[model samples]
Target: MKVFYYLKHIGLALLPHSWFTRRQRKLEQKFADQQDYIQRRVDYYLKTAQPFTLAPEETTAIADYTRRGFTSYFYDLKEYLHYFPKQCRFAYYFGDETHIEPRHTLFKARPIAGDNERSVIFKLDKRRHFRFVEDTLSFAEKKPMAVFRGAVTQPHRIRFMETLFGHPLVDAGQSNPSETHPEWQQPFMSVEDQLQYKFLFALEGNDVASNLKWAMSSNSLVFTPKMVFETWFMEGTLQAGVHYVEVKDDFSDVEEKINYYLAHPEKAQQIIDNAHAYLAPYQNPDLEDLVCIKVLERYFSLSGQLEK
Candidate 1:
């Protein structure tokens, strides 16, 4: 993503540089046109006539969930996970003592060097024990700055989802909602792909959330499609199963995960099956994309994007 942006910028930068030299700036123009086309497509997606932001039932359910500090975790996750980067010009996340600490503090975290130190800490609310490691000049320069130590265990991961979501993650090998219409059929879009992108986008919005968190096996590593469904769904609701899982905050890692999944034959088959089961609910072709889009609209509204 950053490379795309840089290429787009460098291409334009060449225009000014070329003006002084007067050679054919054809390549620069091509890059500029490409960038513009990409931007236009994104704008179209955003501006398309979306379904209502949320159904009345959905709004009521979400409001009730929030009072308990639990909303539709998947929906919120999807919004914060995906839509942000495509929308915001300068989007980044920061983790610091203030947001990570038990309570808010005046010592806020900033991007650049200051009193802020790179560190990793785990807070177990039940035990009230904060386990952490301090940062040094050496560690900060590496590719991924370490934060939380010890991989989040599977049980703990489930517990975390339950805590934030008010329920367990969806289960695997469960039945999908029965299709209603005779014309309904599975669409081409991949549900797992949509989920990965959405999750990545959400991670991008949080300041404490690292770009490496997904690749490092924190949230991304732990949440496989099978595991995600198993954790979220009920006993029999998820009919088929989960397909591929990819969670990477970094742009390069994102592309790598996509490629890795694509290349793995066995994994790809499972992913396809899982996505089909998930798509069973929206048997109507028109409603398949609507499912994701409507969820996102609800998310943005909850996050105050729809407010006048």
Candidate 2:
């Protein structure tokens, strides 16, 4: 798929230079259409025009970016930069630290709200974080219990995993082995394995829950507390009960929420449907390219780079 994206980008480069510029102009107008879904997302991601500039030495050419992190970040960003010179400058971050706030850099995670202006989001590490599953099991066919399998490295998840790790209604366990809690260690379960259950946990780890995009795409109902971190998925826009069953930060309400949904399959199915609808737009590769291009254009325009 990455090769196909590269070939398509090379194909686009053969078109007249004006074609790319015109495409960007049309998309900028699309971002202005207040009623458009794409516009709403663009607005949320890049709320205000943050005018800034970078010294030549401070900027790293996108091609020259170190590939120590996921090489997938390079592929995702460069796919949209075929029109620009290889030396075009960009700043980026590719790590688990959620506090990353560069003046203008491509980053994976950002706060859902408050003190977020310095961060500019792009779909970095998309293959890992945003990959969706093809869940065929229906909400009714799956078991009533919820399942969770991940490292207990995040502060938010420690208590939940400790308290409910052995609960009868859940199959929760730590996948990453820990010397402190060797008893809770279990083999990793694929997204498909978790799909067998009617409720899937989308607990936040370093930033946003890495399993969230795929979990929401599945047939099972997702159980999560309120989201504090967001990526390209717009976690803040998700309403409790409509997209997923909201649980208390503690596992205080997990069983109650899961039992309610088990009894009301219709309500569970509705949340699954809403989740699929939310994820539908992101499935398109062309739309992804266009949105990324619009974002890059804004970064360049506001930073005084496009003027050159």
Top TM-score prediction, candidate number: 2
Task: Please identify model 2 stretches exceeding 4 Å from their true place.
Answer: 1-35, 85-87, 100-102
lDDT per residue for candidate 2 within 1-308, as digits (tens), equals 87986686568757776777787667556646533666566666666666787667767875575547567776677666755555668777777656755566667888887878667777777878878889988988999899999889777788878879889999989988778789888887877789999999999888888999999999999999888988888888899989888898877988888778878899899999999998998998657767777677667767776753
What TM-score would candidate 2 get against the native? 0.87
Clash number for candidate 1 = 27
Model 2 Cα shift for residue 257 (angstroms)? 0.9
For lDDT, the strongest prediction is 2
Instruction: Show where candidate 1 strays beyond 4 Å.
Output: 1-28, 32-37, 44-243, 246-265, 268-308
Q: In angstroms, give how far residue 289 of model 1 lies from its true place.
A: 28
